[model samples]
Target: NAGVIQTPRHKVTGKGQEATLWCEPISGHSAVFWYRQTIVQGLEFLTYFRNQAPIDDSGMPKERFSAQMPNQSHSTLKIQSTQPQDSAVYLCASSLQGGSNERLFFGHGTKLSVL
Candidate 1:
């Protein structure tokens, strides 16, 4: 089926290390978004891109979060100097470059654990 693909379903990292996650979107979609969800903070919009260009990132935290969509079919989220506060389910969703936010299809998520 054509859907978003996220890897490592789970990740364990040290408090001050780097964590890199991968994603593959549906074949022709051009908009991608990254969202972070946690029991304590609910769902937060991290960032989004359209046609390989970032469209909005007003919800991303200021510390160490970054996202990139190098091509039309894939993207990645990288966390530098991870912290316990950063532990959460990282999700990637995609849709057509403009218009209605298509029914976002999510991956199984990459649950991160910082210790």
Candidate 2:
């Protein structure tokens, strides 16, 4: 299996622009998750899907950010009006079973830089 694949390992955008990060989960995996990594928050869970269904997303910012799993194999994280503060390493993870405590394998992550 290819494991989780996050495209555009690095991205740079101007403030007020939009940024979209993509992820391809492992084959046959039922759960895919999104997270943001930063010095302050460490690994902050953003959202996830189980069996291609949206699950919890309370940790995500109410505005300017959104996550979606359109199919079993892939998911996307979109940020509108990107700001300097939004710059961070966006990570995607997946596991065979879906649960908060389940062991997850993570992608290398997409580093977003805003200027």
Candidate 3:
């Protein structure tokens, strides 16, 4: 079975443009997670969902970043008015169980570049 599927492995956008990232979790997984990686912030958990229901989004920036799990198979992360600082590797992970202590399988991640 596939671990996770992330489309448009690499994306480039203008500083003010909007960017959308996609993820397909493994079948049978109950939880999905999103994270951002940058030089300054090694790995920052952005948001997550369990059984297609949003769980936590405290890590997301109130202004331009948002994530949604509309269904079981897929999830989306959107960044509006993109800035250079938004450039980073956006990772998606999923697990059979969700909590502070659970093993998660991650995707290759979508690398976003804001110019």
- Best lDDT goes to which candidate? 3
Task: List model 2 lDDT by residue over 20-42, tens digit each.
Answer: 99999989889998999999989
lDDT of 3 by residue, 1-115 (tens): 9789998799999999999999999998989999999989899999989998888898999999989998899999999999999999999999987967889999999999999
- Candidate 1 per-residue lDDT, tens place, 9-106, comes to 99999999999999998778888888898998888889988889999988887678888888887898989999998899998888766457367777
TM-score, ranked from best to worst: 3, 2, 1
* Global lDDT scores for all candidate models: 0.86, 0.93, 0.94
What lDDT, from 0 to 1, does candidate 2 have?
0.93
Q: Summing lDDT over every window of 10 consecutive residues in candidate 3, give the lowest-scoring window.
A: 95-104
The better candidate by TM-score, 1 or 2, is 2
TM-score of 2: 0.96
Residue ranges of candidate 1 with Cα displaced over 4 Å:
none
Candidate 3: which stretches are off by over 4 Å? Answer: none
